[model samples]
Target: MRKDRKNTHLKCCIMEISGRITKDAVTAKVSNDREVVNFSIAINDSYRPKGAEELKKIVTYIDCSYWMGSKMAQWLKKGTVVELFGRIGLNVYNNAEGKALGSLTFHTSNIKILVFPKTENSSSLPAVQKKNTDQDTPDDLPF
Candidate 1:
């Protein structure tokens, strides 16, 4: 978290999280006809306690909103693994039964798609493309 000069409150709370999209992203229009992309991601983690024979698995879901552009919603499909950089926030509210509940939210500034979900027709898994090293370099060099 980045604080202001006075340190009264946080100016920016930038954080990076990598997770899989829980569902397809949704775009909604707000005041003044502005649009926002909303989505949720599930982060999976596991830990082994001391003197434990098994690992305990945990899953945390965080709601994310992107105000930069709504066009990116098309590519933020379900099961897409992505790395998000943004401000992290927590919303604490009281439930009807007087229980305190807290929810995590991320105001996304940038997104990087890590992996796309497999399609029915595809037999092999998708992978990031690497540069071909077999190609010869041109002799016309400025260096």
Candidate 2:
């Protein structure tokens, strides 16, 4: 008997996460003469057990590598919240003694900044002066 071939293509696994940056992004040059930005995000989860009065918070750290460019590294500062979409992967490497080590990694394809850290002088900008006029302006305008 022959088997059916309706859908032979494997499904892709994409991961999406939103969290705050644990630290500033770092750029590194690979062997292929390409630069990549590496950073980590902290995702906070909270849950209360059945009939519990206190909230329990759990933080998960995700290691991410962005292949877009090093320009994005400047925006990924510590305490900045970001949303990322990418594919999850496991990086496997051998130790000095030939021991295997595996780590959870995320290869980010898209990233968006949600919030940025506030600066001390951000709200101290001088106010701009506007032109004063007594005439009323028309409200009708053409598209």
Candidate 3:
């Protein structure tokens, strides 16, 4: 029998990023009769250069596409913080002006909402009790 040269130790690459949504998600139908949700996210970072006295903030924008159900688009609104896990993709194309353009894309396999931006009507909600300690609990136990 011939020897098999397949390498079983090869590793796959995975990327995870957390950022705020730049805008609401949009849904579109693909050629395969499937719906996809498209959105953008902005990741911000601050760092001080080698000899700089002050720190500078850098923002990286990434376009993301989700192939799951379109219902998720409704919850992904602007300013919502989300955590995404997926692979990175680079897309190159020509714009309407015939100029070459390139963009970084994140093909997200999984996404989670980290924080929902507070709305003006949120204040109308009732406040929750902080403590439920035994000292404050009623002695009427069914046990």
Candidate 4:
């Protein structure tokens, strides 16, 4: 809550959500040659209903857009987990068939990388180092 010049209190809607990236981020030039990073995340949630013996799983996918820069797209790969802080918005529009559709959108202001997906190249580094270390002798050490 914040007070404006009129001495009235105002409410701000800011949300934080953490989820796994659904796909690699894409950069697009929207207007005035400005680039925006676009990505989607899947948030997994589960809940148990009353008198239920099992838990029900739910997944919510939110489309995110970051206007700060496009360089962050390189790290925002599929399966990477990130925490985003921003505002949520709902877009309601009519489809080509005249049916109404709605989707959730997040205007991300800040992003924190939580977990990075392991790539084949990254996963092979340790094995290659281990193989080299196994062949090394104490006499090979210059020190």
Candidate 5:
């Protein structure tokens, strides 16, 4: 039996996710033969209370998929930090062990390279060793 997901807000118009890419972008054509890109990302969230002992933080990993042109698929990579806004999607699949598995994927309408947030955290930006390396993906989510 599969656990029912109470939070079925996959249709949320926009969301801000800041985390490390878990896998390289997988590009494929949708059933309609339309180009689509898919990838997984993990977001880290912890808790810290004042005048308290050690606390554990909740970490969330959301699978992201970009159903767009081929240009977007060619621009995904592991460990790349990105901030995106799009709708959420879910899919069921069978693993090598033949067990039914489910995944939460994000269908982005637009994405951008995170530069700087109100808080100063340079680590969120992509670390490109080469000065002129291109890091923009073909993400076109709704603004």
Candidate 6:
């Protein structure tokens, strides 16, 4: 009884995450012979104005990660503004009191820096390249 052809034929999954970066840390290491960059991105949810009750702005934090690469980890710092496109993965962490803390990981596919972080040791991202070299190499085989 499925009559929706557009929904079945085209598979679309796009998640866009945007917020002020918080608790941003970068650590690159080889764990069990595999290299991975471990980092965290905090997303804050801003509260919308709800009528005339006179409430302050509420903020919520969400922790995310990217396992695809460490380029973002090395280039970001706390309080940096960023927009990201990524997939989601969930993980569980425990504190010293034995309580479980869970987080959703964003495996980054694309990242855009909105603003430089406001810290003394804030990281500097690599500069964007403005060169195109697709026509520099010949496609015809000489052999």
User: lDDT winner among the candidates?
Assistant: 1
Q: After superposition, how far is residue 20 of candidate 4 from its true place, in Å?
A: 0.3
Show the colliding residue pairs in model 3.
none
* Best first by TM-score, ranked: 1, 4, 3, 2, 5, 6
Q: Which stretches of candidate 6 lie over 4 Å from their true place?
A: 1-12, 30-33, 48-51, 92-101, 119-143
RMSD of each: 8.2, 10.8, 10.8, 9.7, 11.3, 13.4
Q: Which candidate, 3 or 4, would have the higher lDDT against the true structure?
A: 4
In terms of lDDT, model 6 sits at: 0.61
Candidate 3 Cα deviation (angstroms), residue 117: 0.9
Model 6 per-residue lDDT tens digits across residues 1-143:
22211211123376888877775556556676455544455655445476855655655455555556655576667777888887665556565666656646666677788887655542354555668877887898697
Query: Which digits, one per residue and each the tens of the lDDT, describe model 3 over residues 32-91?
Result: 779999999999999999999999999999999999778788888888899999888876
lDDT per residue (tens digit) for residues 67-126 in model 5: 656676544666667788887767776666667677777777777755322226644444
Task: State the lDDT of candidate 2 residue by residue for 1-143, as single tens digits.
Answer: 21221212223677788999998899998857799999999999999989999999999888999998788897888888999998877656666666666666778999989887665754432333667654565576474
TM-score of each: 0.76, 0.68, 0.72, 0.75, 0.59, 0.56
Order of candidates by lDDT, top first?
1, 4, 3, 2, 5, 6
Model-by-model lDDT, in order? 0.84, 0.79, 0.81, 0.83, 0.68, 0.61
Query: Candidate 2 overall Cα lDDT vs. reference?
Result: 0.79
Model 2: how far residue 91 lies from native, Å: 3.1
Question: What's the CA error at residue 113 for candidate 2, in Å?
Answer: 0.5
